[model samples]
Target: MYKNIKVIAFDADDTLWVNETYFREAEHQFAKLLAKYETENKIDQELFRKEIENLAYYGYGVKGFILSMIECALELSNYKINPKTIEAILNIGKKMLNEPIELLDGIEEVLSSLQDRFKLIVATKGDLLDQERKLEKSNLLNYFHHIEVMSDKKEKDYKKLIKHLDIHPSEFLMIGNSLKSDVLPLIEIGASAIHIPFHTTWAHEEISEEASNNFKYHTVANIKDVLRLF
Candidate 1:
């Protein structure tokens, strides 16, 4: 199916390494720190709402998440959240920032095998500095022809990326875990996509499976399975 594909783009976070897992852990820690003010469920819901609301203002990544956590803490505490709790929240973000980049199984092997056959690039959305740091730590940076840290992942964004890379939509293939951010948009833009499901996904990135039925894309059980496609 990808015989014509000349450029293979990958989603860095969950696809290449563990990301949402860290966010989930941080959320748990945040909820525990605020347990004095609200139930964990309510805290989780409010934090998610705040994150979505703040997406445009802070964009995506750990810094934005830290800001949202702090805002949620203040609101849930009725503006009397303890300064120490705020410090704890900031510490959670710092811990995540320092966590090692644990690459998904077979990522290196797949990249090594395909590096000679296709132009590999990382097309992901997140805070630029943090993403660059993780990529540098992963030591997978040498495999990609380009690194695109997108502000958003919509059809228009993919269109712009294709134009920037000087490739026809038909010549591009994107592989990622989110159907909303990764698969559907690429399909809409006339590019091929492969969905690799991660164990956990943020609520905002989840979409009904029915929404994906309209498009033609591939789903794989493991990252290594993608090697079979090319």
Candidate 2:
């Protein structure tokens, strides 16, 4: 199915490294910080809603996420939250920023194997500087020919990327953990995609089974398994 593929774009978060797990952890940490204001469940729900609601203003990544947490805290606390707690929330984000890069198992193997056969690139959505910093720390930077820190991963975004790469949609393949952002959009644009399920997924990135039931794509158990397609 991937024989026509000339370029392979891999999503950064969760696909190449452990990302969603950190976000989940951050959410839990956030919940604890706001525990007096609301239950953890309510906090999670409200924070997710806030994140989606603020997407237009903040976009995606740690910076936006931190802002969402602050806003959620303010609302949940009815604006009664202490300034010290606000400082603590900011600290949560700082700690996440400084966390060490934990590369997924076999990620290097997959990239090393496929680098020579295809124009490998990182097509991910996040703060550009944060993504670049992670890439540099990953030491896997040299494997990719290009790195696109996209604002959003929609069909049009992929089309623009394909156009920039001077390749047809059919010749492009996206391998990532999020079906909503990485897989479905590519399939919609007539490109191929391989879904590598991550252990954790952000709520906004989840799609219903009904939404993906009609799509034709490949799902591998792991990143290393993607190599078997060739």
Winner by TM-score? 1
What's the TM-score of every candidate structure? 0.99, 0.98
Worst 10 residues of 2 by lDDT: 15-24
**In candidate 2, what are the lDDT values of residues 30-149, reduced to their tens digit?**
999998878999999999999999999988999999999999999999999999999999999998898899999999998989999999999999898999999999999999999999
Relative to the true structure, candidate 2 has a C-alpha RMSD (angstroms) of 0.8
Off by over 4 Å in 2: none
Give the local distance difference test score of model 1.
Answer: 0.96
Summarize candidate 1's per-residue lDDT along 1-230 as a digit string, tens digits. Answer: 78899999999999999999999999999989988888999999999999999999999999999999999999999999889888999999999999998999999999999999999999999999999999999999999999999999999999999999998999999999999999999999899999999999999999997898899999999999998886
lDDT of 1 at 113: 97
What's the lDDT for candidate 2? 0.93
| Candidate lDDT values, in order | 0.96, 0.93
